[model samples]
Target chain A: MAIDRSHIGVVSEPREIDVEKGQLRFFAKATGEINPVYFDEEAARAAGHPTIPAPPTFLFSLQLGAPAKRGDIFDPENGIGVDVRRILHGEQRFTYHRPIYAGDRMTLTTTTTDIYDKKGGALEFITQKTQGVNAAGQLCVEMQVVTVVRNG
Target chain B: MVSPVQYVDTAALAVGDRLPDHAMGPLNRGTLALFAGASNDHVPLHIDSDFAKAAGMPDVFGHGMLSMAYLAQMITHWVPQERLRTWNVRFMAITPLYATVICRGEVTEIFTDNGERLARLSIGSWIDDATQTLGGEAIIALD
Candidate 1:
């Protein structure tokens, strides 16, 4: 089944999330990060950070905390209609405007940027761009993800 | 325990210089489960063999984000996390279970952008069997 091209440019409702120190530590440990700045607040301060700065790529996980709105483009039924099993993460990109600290609150919004197919419709791709802005209204990060769905 | 960190001198860096390789794994179910919980990505395809088999994979595989995280760790080891301007990756292949991954990066270009020196690096992660599972690029501000 072909994805709905009309979904392009659709934006999700903004979601707010608090960055927490414990969660950052957990993520650091999970990824085998040994950097003290990611684990110890004192070390982070010593390293010239205001607080425990989020490790690189940590924003990707933080964005996932937002609840998926039903009938969104990722939905298997009413949205793109591709089965969940068929979807694969194809590409991911992150452009950081500023460092995100653990004490910050970020507002995240995702927009469907593009939709297309390849391999004669055997592979469908959905591109979505997500931005995280701090409470002060400064953009902290921009992430673009490409999702590939296989059709048989 | 806080470990000793050696920050890279980006000003002294030259193009074609390779960052130290960061290696992790022989990834197991525990790592996948821990990552799934920590990252809030609970997709069963990473943790459930049955689900992966049903999805046409022989077994559960590592998440691309997990590999990307490792790559991020590698980049930060060379420079500060705050120095990262951009990072990107493309999933080239599925990383099989128990495959140890080595993340490597090479500085491809160095130049000044708006008075801040920056280094653009070509980065990728290779499995123990030498399969390049992910390819990516990163740009970092040099102090």
Candidate 2:
């Protein structure tokens, strides 16, 4: 199915998350990252981080899991299949305000910024605007992610 | 067991110092798919080889974040695993997984003030077959 570019816009759905140390450590281990800075707080502070720093890609685990809107780009009935086997990661970019540490509770509001059809697939550009204080609410980390959709 | 020590000596680093070349690639569908699942980004572009072929791509590509994650792995190797405070990364273009890509980084600047040490580095991923699929940079903080 061909997609109309104009249909793309902001997807305003609210999602909340609380950062957990164990989960963050799991991410580090899953990625095969053996950084003590991620598991040992003393090592982290000794190394310069205020606390154990979350991996750059670990932010995805914190998404609020809100449902994508109807008439939206990746909606199954709208054309794209929800099947995991049919999809692949097209590209991802991250901009960080600060390194995420354990105990940071945050909320994220993701908006679909753009959707375009290129040759045989669709591109979903999403901007996840997140804002929340750290355990002390002293710092905030904001990020945006882009996903590609292919015809399965 | 003694944990591995992956560290960078900010005092020893200079602007334009390039990291040793690290190679990764010939990516498989399984790795890409699993990465998507683990990352909660189940987009079809990386998992569906058929979908990618239909879309005119040579083949399925790796997750952009996955690539960035791999780059971060390199940083972990260079700097003592314990010193990283925070890091930010960005992507310039799509990197394919069909061929080997050489990931490289250069220290752009290093500075310390008030007992805090910091370094800004420019990192990139280049296709071993060609200088294509150029990636991005990382700003890292250290103790």
Candidate 3:
């Protein structure tokens, strides 16, 4: 089956998350980041951040904490109908308007922007847009994520 | 595990300048599992060898976001994390397990807008020193 084009423009409910220092530290360490600002409070303050500022890809991790248990669009019930076994990440992009710090509470909203296929529908591409907003309702990051599913 | 934090000076950059490349791992299962746990992306294809083999893949693979994180590490090391104005990448091929990949970028363009000096970086990840697994661009601002 081809991807569900009717699902295009579908938007998910807002997912609210509180940025945690320990989580940030874990992410930093896992990704091999040795920046003090991610581990030391005083260093982060000295660097002019309120607390530990998340590493760039940290927000991508936070996005996974979306209220929905299944964050991937191709999950069985997301209505897109792509099998998890065939999906491959296609493209990932982020436009940062400002830094996000630990101890910040933010909301994330994801929307399906477009869906199409190529190679006689053997590969389907789904493009989604996700926005992160700080507690003050400021736009912090705009993430453009694409997933490609192979149908054979 | 951590390199010294060195901010990239726009004054030090010009069109076609090559930024320092970040050599990432001979990625193994342990590293992949740790990343999956930390990132909360425990997709079976990344952590389950059996699932991957069932899917016709040789074994578990690394997450694309993990590759993206490597590129981001390169960017953050060069500038303050907050100065990253834009980032983008395309996952062209699967970066298989235990394969070493280097994340790299070059200064492709430099310009100023609204008093912000910005640099455009052409970026990619290369596997086994030959195959380009991912490709994209990023923009950073130096005020």
Candidate 4:
């Protein structure tokens, strides 16, 4: 069967994820980052942000959608054998439209962009892009996330 | 003004030591493209100079996860592999490619769970020119 090229740009349901302080704080410590723009509200304000901005890699927490909901591409029931334990992060890439702030409201939409069959395991690519906007409708951030799956 | 922290003793790094803050430069399209090529991420938004302008960005942007990975690389580079059990990260903000960004981290809590010492870590990257860009926490196990 030929791969459907149109599916690459297919849109999925909009997933909403709230931004909070504690989780952002935890992420900062875990990555060993000390940028004041992530922690100091005053500093962020002085720097012209609405509030303290979270780190670049914090997009993984936003539950854009579940694997099953992603259809046969990530379907654990039938399509590909879904095994979590044996999986390793193959790679991740991000392209930002703007910066994000603490009080920003974020909406994530995920699409099963692509899938490849490897000799050892199936390599799946999931792209979740979160678009954040302030109350003023100004775009604050554009976050893109990807992950790899391996048979456990 | 923020003051740089000088750790007196490496052993004194408890579960709550915060690293000194540092400033990065203004990000640009050229730098973002460099990172994209170096990391093998060729998304048009990150490399195609014209595409970025079409998308309304001044220039191509950097990969947020790449920035996160940079911090991860820093941690592993500073600490030995034997002291690490596992590492993971998430990208929260759009770290523009050529934009200058400040990366920093802190130790929140440390504990021994199931016969393994673990460190709760927090880290983030901020666009120096802009206000906020990215941040996240990690769980590190010590052997």
In terms of TM-score, which candidate is strongest?
1
What local lDDT score does residue B137 receive in model 3, on the 0 to 100 scale? 92
Q: Give per-residue CA lDDT, model 1, range B9-31, as digits (tens).
A: 88799999999999999899999
Estimate, for each residue in B71-121, the C-alpha lDDT of model 3 and write its tens digit.
888887788877788888989988989888798899898888888888889
Q: What share of the true interface contacts does each candidate keep?
A: 0.86, 0.22, 0.86, 0.03
Off by over 4 Å in 1: A70-73, A76-81, B1-3
Estimate, for each residue in A1-152, the C-alpha lDDT of model 1 and write its tens digit: 88878888878778899998899989988988888899889989888998898877777787777744532555654355567798899999999989889989999888888999999999999998888999999999999989998989
Q: Write the per-residue lDDT of candidate 4 for residues A17-83, one digit (tens) a residue.
A: 5667665565554334455555677756765667776554444444422222433333454333334
Please state the Cα-based DockQ of model 4 relative to the true two-chain complex: 0.04
TM-score of each: 0.96, 0.66, 0.94, 0.45
Query: In order, how many clashes per candidate?
Result: 0, 17, 0, 46
lDDT of 3 by residue, A1-152 (tens): 87657778788878899988888888877777766877888878888888888777777788877643333475667546567898888999898887788888989988888989999998888998889999999998889888888888
Least well predicted 10-residue stretch by lDDT in candidate 4 chain B: B3-12
Clashing pairs in 3: none
For residue B87, give model 3's deviation from the true position in Å: 1.4
The alpha-carbon lDDT assigned to residue B104 of candidate 4 equals 74
Which ten residues in a row are the worst by lDDT in model 4 chain A?
A: A64-73
